[model samples]
Target: MTGDNERPAYERGTGFLLARLGSLTARSWTAFLTEHRLTQAQYTVLVALQQHGPVGQRRLAELVAMDARNIVPVLDSLAAGCLIERRPDDTDRRRRTITLTGGGNALLAAVADAAAVEQDQFLHALNATERARLNHLLRRLYDSHIPEAPQPG
Candidate 1:
């Protein structure tokens, strides 16, 4: 535990490195989202709704990997902001489906573009090819680790 040139064990760990990277990016992203009146959870919900179209609350929770009960608050906030609306499912009168409002789509489009720019700035140390390769590898690993439902195109 006493070497002038040796790095610590945590510093050498992949998980630790990922966590450090997440922390660095999260701070900036959180602030940026706050300026747009969004939290990460709320933004995720809006993005999922945009991608999947209208879905029931339970299904939306599954898509976002969040507990159905826990997502209620996020949904409520979005509804309060008029970013989304819950409507009675046509097929099933018992359940409500969530749909993104036009305002939500507009906000998502603007924020998504800016977010991409922010992400590029964060990964500026990596060249374009390197960034692409890294993203591919990360997506591969994530896909293998998380059993994902096929998303609709």
Candidate 2:
């Protein structure tokens, strides 16, 4: 085992770096999303809908790393703006499925472009390949450390 004092500050301080990165990333995304009149949570939900097709509210919440209650207001805003529609699941009247509308898809496209620029600006020192690798590593860390809710079919 390596002694705590044997590593440089940067090497020994991954937790600090991770926390800062998370905070900075959220701030960056929020700034980018604000231009689209979206919160980071709405952008996240839009992305999830684009990727997953229609999904239950809980499933969508999990996709966006939010609690079910927290996702409701975002969904309501989207619904009111005609960006998304919520309907009862065919199999269960009590379960609602969330889907992106055509408007949502168009909005997401615009937001995605902004997201790319924001990501590039945030990680300007990293090349495309390095960015990909960093995403892979972060996903691996998340998979190992955070237990996800089982996705519904």
Candidate 3:
């Protein structure tokens, strides 16, 4: 049996690197977005809507990798801020579609600028080529996990 001070080989290797990288990235994003009065989740939602356009709530939740129930409060707050609107889906009244309002678009533009600056500062240790490689690897990892469509609720 290993003592408390001893870690298994895997724990001290790839697992440690992955955990540290994930935590650092998450913290950097949280701090950067919070400076603009947005949580990581809100920023993610806005980015998704910006990219995909008017999307159903469930689909939005999936795109952002959030639970449907958790997404409701975020959507509610965005709607209350006049950043987005929820309208009944033309095809399915039971489903609501979310779209960014002009205000939301403007906010997203500002946030995108801030995010770019934040990313530069966050990855200052990496060169342009390294950053590009890191981004490509991360995208591949995500694509391997998340499906193209939201799983039916």
Q: How many clashing residue pairs, candidate 2?
A: 0
Q: Which stretches of candidate 1 lie over 4 Å from their true place?
A: 1-15, 149-153
lDDT of 2 by residue, 48-150 (tens): 9999999999888888889899889999999998999999999999999999999999998887787777777878888889989999999999999999867
Clashes of 1: 0
Candidate numbers, best lDDT first, in rank order = 1, 3, 2
What number of clashing residue pairs does each candidate have, in the order they appear? 0, 0, 0
Maximum-TM-score candidate? 1
Per-residue lDDT tens digits for candidate 1, residues 1-153, read: 456349788787899988998798789989999989999999999999999899999999988989999999999999999999999999998888999999999999999899899888888889999999999999998999988776646
- Order the candidates by TM-score, highest first: 1, 2, 3
* lDDT of model 2 at position 125: 81
Best by lDDT: 1
Candidate 1: 10-residue stretch with minimal lDDT: 1-10
Task: Supply candidate 3's per-residue lDDT for 60.
Answer: 94
Residue 100 in candidate 3, Cα distance off native in Å: 0.5
lDDT of 3 by residue, 16-130 (tens): 8789888998888888778888877888898899999999998899888899999999998899889899999999999999999999999999988987988898788899999
Instruction: Indicate the TM-score of model 3.
Output: 0.74
Candidate 2 overall lDDT versus native: 0.87
